[model samples]
Target: MSLCIENLRAWYGAAQVLHGVNLVIGEGEAVALAGRNGSGRSTLAKAIMGLVRCEGDMRYRDVRLVGLRPYRIARLGIGYVPETRDVFPALTVRENLLLGERKGTRFTTHEAYRLFPALEARAAVKAGLLSGGEQQMLALARTLAGDPSFVVIDEPGEGLAPHVLAQVAACLKTLRERGVAMLLIEERLTIARMLDARVAVMGHGAIRFDGPIEAFARDAQVMREWLFVG
Candidate 1:
């Protein structure tokens, strides 16, 4: 497995967000994490990335990840594209990609540009100046520049237009083709369907359901109880 978690718990200050969550992702597999707002989907991503105070067994290819620092976890070939799209505002698009590179990474700035031509067109422009969709592309491209074996992306389709969302989905498909494992966090199943990924639904800080996407689509009870808001 690329990632394995057992009894995972996470916290921000005194408030606990994750509750004994367990999940696994195989090499080159994509799992879409779906949930309503505040259901701890983002918290799970943060826990995996070592960005939150977490406990229990969290491993990336047998490496213990529970107590590691964020940068250390990142160096272990785990990449994160936050929901906030935290690109370096002062840096140019090309510079941002350069900053994400690792010594032995197979992905390169040139490849990132090829994946997102809009970024290539604005290579010299500061990241802060890019449009929302363009910034989202840059964020994903920059993470790819690191050549991680696994990535945790939060809300890739949030607030994006249909055309731009399609472009992002295409980029993710390319990553899957290259055998990169991913944990895609989102509120809806649209992008998950596009990626042909398995679905894991979260509720009350725990996984309510974990199964094939087709199975998830067929399970109306699970959706009404865990995914839909009354």
Candidate 2:
């Protein structure tokens, strides 16, 4: 497994957010984590990146990730794209990509630009000046510039227009082809379907369902109880 989590628990100050979460991602595989609001999907991503106070086992390949800092985990080949799309507002598009580069990473600014030409067109513009969809693209592109072996992406398709979402999906597909494993966190199944990924449903800070995407589709009970909003 490229990434593995066993009995993972996390908290925000005194508020516990995760409860014994277990998951594994194989090399080059993509898993879509689906859930409604406040179900702890985002917490899982944060735990893996060491952003929250966490305990239990989180292993990235052979490295123990439990006590590591976020930057250390990132240097060990894990990338995170938070839902907030944390692009530097004052930085130009090219400068943002430059910051994401690592010592030996093969992924470069050229590849990032190729994946999203819109970003290249605005290379000289500050990130704060771009539209929301464009900012999202820049965030993803910046992450890719690091050439991470695994990535945890949170709410990637959130608030994106259909056309912009399609572009993001295409870029993710290309990454999968290049053997980068990913955990795609989302509330909607549209992008998951586009990626043909496995499904893992989260609720009450635990995994309620984990299976192939087709299995998730046929599980009316799981969908009604956990996914649908009445």
Candidate 3:
């Protein structure tokens, strides 16, 4: 396994948000963490990135990731893109990408541009002026510039137009071809199905179902109760 979480737990101040979340991502695999909003999916991603206080055995390859600083985690080839899309507004597109190249030893800006062609066209433009989808692309591009072996992406499809989402899916496909593993948190079943990745359904701070995406489509009761709780 490239990433493993054993009984992961996290809290916001005094409130516990995650309860014994267990997960694994094998080498070069894209895995989806699927659930409704506020279902602890994002929390799981944050906990793995060490953005919040957490308790559990988080292992990347052979190294234990728990207690490590967020920067340290990033240096260990773990790239994280939070739901907020933390791109610097004042910087030019190229500058924002430069900031993400902190490691000074991994993927190049040109590589990121190749994955997101729109970014290449907007390299000279101010990052703040880009559309939401473009900002999301820049965010992913910035993370990719750091050359993480595995990526943790949170709510990537949120607020994106259907056309833009298709572009994002194509970028993900390219990432897979490059052998970059991913732990994706998304609501769109279509994207999940297209990726044909492993899926884990989360609710109330715990995983309710973990299996193939096709299994999720077949289990109507599971969808109605856990995945599609509308």
Candidate 4:
């Protein structure tokens, strides 16, 4: 099972952003989408989750997903961790994570706790009171607690201290080992390199570079042309 897209296009109130983007992510594969700001990387991510109006073939595990609502997509074991940390401000850390649990689900917060020890240390604390880094962890943990088969995670390293960033990286690595497919969007090329994922560089609302990360990394001309080296 995997996500397969063909000429995906998106619009925001008549303003088209994504123009015929195509990509793929097989089960347990991690792929990074990178480019300069407004390159349609995030727009493509939102389109996959049906958070915006889109056209073209969007399939997940062989099921068409272009017209599905965001919640419907989520129900199919696809998780979206937006750029914002969508936490219940007044809810305790445990409560926030528990809220993500669905009936008959096998995933639990115990795994989340193992991924970010700080979350376990403050299980009873209000989520709003945690630092930016901890809140990011909570948001991710909460989503993963539902046992998503595929995840689209936007930039999670923004505004975090070095140690906290490392924690996020470790958590992602763990998820990969657990066989969760991932679509990652990040500005830091170094972080993208760490995932050993194929790189899809977006430009002008379309994918301009699609290949192995090493291939993308080695091409100084393409890297600089697409804002990867510069």
Cα lDDT of model 2 by residue, 1-230, tens digit: 89988899999999999999999899999999999999999999999998999999889998999999999999889999999999999999999999988766777888878878899999999999999999999999889888899999999998999999999999999889989999999888788899999999999998999999999999999999899896
Weakest ten-residue segment in model 4 by summed lDDT: 221-230
The Cα local distance difference test for each model comes to 0.92, 0.92, 0.87, 0.88
Off by over 4 Å in 2: none
Order the candidates by lDDT, highest first: 2, 1, 4, 3
What's the candidate order when arranged by decreasing TM-score?
A: 2, 1, 4, 3
RMSD of candidates 1 onward, in order: 0.9, 0.9, 1.6, 1.5
- Residue-level lDDT of model 3, residues 16-68, one tens digit each, is 99998888899999989888888899889988888888998889998999899
Q: Candidate 1 lDDT, tens digit per residue, 83-120?
A: 99999999999899999887777888888887788889
The digit string of per-residue lDDT tens for model 4 on 116-185 reads 8999999999999999899999998988888898989899788889898888888888888889999999
Error of 1 at 69 (Å): 0.5
Superior candidate under lDDT, 3 versus 4: 4
| Residue 93, model 2: Cα distance from true site in angstroms | 0.5
Model 4's lDDT to the true fold? 0.88
- Which has the higher lDDT value, candidate number 2 or candidate number 4? 2
